[model samples]
Target: MTTARGDSPADETGGLTRVLVADDQALVRAGFVALLDAQDDIEVVGEADNGEEAVRLTRQLIPDVVLMDIRMPILDGLGATRTIAGEPGLAGVRVVILTTFELDEYVFEALRSGATGFLVKHTEPADLLRAIRVVAAGDALLSPGVTRRLVAQFASHAKQPASGADLAELTDRERDVMTLVAEGLTNAEIAGRLYLSPATARTHVSRILLKLGARDRTQLVVIAYESGLVRPGWQ
Candidate 1:
């Protein structure tokens, strides 16, 4: 993807989050660039018209976060996300998918492909900005309520049964943390429920991720469901 200059002034010196917007629609890209550029802590660094370009610009410009639209001309957002997430050099970069349908099938695939989270196109600007910041700060953006419904809707259709052996490496406390994580509890919520310090809860979550070889909280949720660590419609 070729880099297009943004309307806002550059603020790389201010420790701002650099962002790249990728969408097939010019209007959508322009609107996102304008909204994100207005923020004090965010700078719209570049824009791309397709997934292939998005991937190229990601490697070239190395922006902190990518606002990626799922459908595009050449390559799709899922393909681009896979490329970005698979590269060790681009590990610092994150992707938040843009989709029109809230429960689009591609959304699940996007998450599996390494996208941190997704937002429907009609999402409030404030929420959109928040999602960008959340992903950029190294956190996944799946809300608990939405995650539960999504997972419940899809989990039963999974071809493989949940596996107990996959979680053999985790200690009992780490398993508890993983269950809460799969339930979409933030570290603070997990800390409160388990009577642990937030820092301790965070550490537990980190250890769980490391042990499971998961990329982020979303993957942890997937594991919780797929490994039968947590199930739908059961307390």
Candidate 2:
């Protein structure tokens, strides 16, 4: 079921991050809506009780981000994520999975399903807002801690070895940036380390994502490790 809510005036938010809260629990949905509504830069545009409704409202409202719960009645978050990801029109939309468990298997699957990131339910409200902004800005929510856990979980499941041609496509500077990105450095850190402006660092990252066909920074990290561009002990 989807909750119909009045659309907040755009001028009120000054180009706010329109969000759809998707969870099965009424209280949980209400809590998220209230928290987000309190922020001047974010607005709760709609609420969905299941994955199906989430996907439906997402197509209709075309929000900037979705705070999606992993467990839902009709369709799980992963399915909704995949559906959204597969739609070219939804490219500007990002999904952030909300879960109670930090290292659940679904976390990995959610990434593959096109989630920008996963946040544990107990995350601080400030961090939650920051994650939304990060994802909405076309960056993945892969903090160092999250990257460490993900690498530890998926290291053994590396895909087919990346060919030398994969490395050949990146320039030396781009490769350097890739390594730092793999190490979970944010654009700000990378900028400081490489003596580049933050905008330049972000441009390099965006190019890397495009050239490597990675969905986000998390996949970039996986490519770095699995491709032997960065080794397990390097970081």
Residue-by-residue lDDT tens digits, candidate 2, 1-235: 5874654323254688888999999998888888999998888889999999999888888888999999998899989998998798888788888999877777766776677788888888899889888888876454666755676576557454322237778999999999998888889999999999999999999999888777678667766776778776676
* Candidate that would win on TM-score: 1
Q: Native-vs-model 1 lDDT?
A: 0.80
- Candidate 1 clash pair list: 1-53
Any runs in candidate 1 off by more than 4 Å, and if so which? 4-11, 158-165
Lowest summed lDDT across 10 adjacent residues in model 2 is found at 156-165
Q: Against the true structure, what is every candidate's RMSD?
A: 3.3, 3.2
Question: TM-score of each candidate?
Answer: 0.89, 0.85
lDDT of 1 by residue, 43-154 (tens): 8888999999998888777888899999998999988988898898887788888999867667766766677778888999998888888888877444556766666667
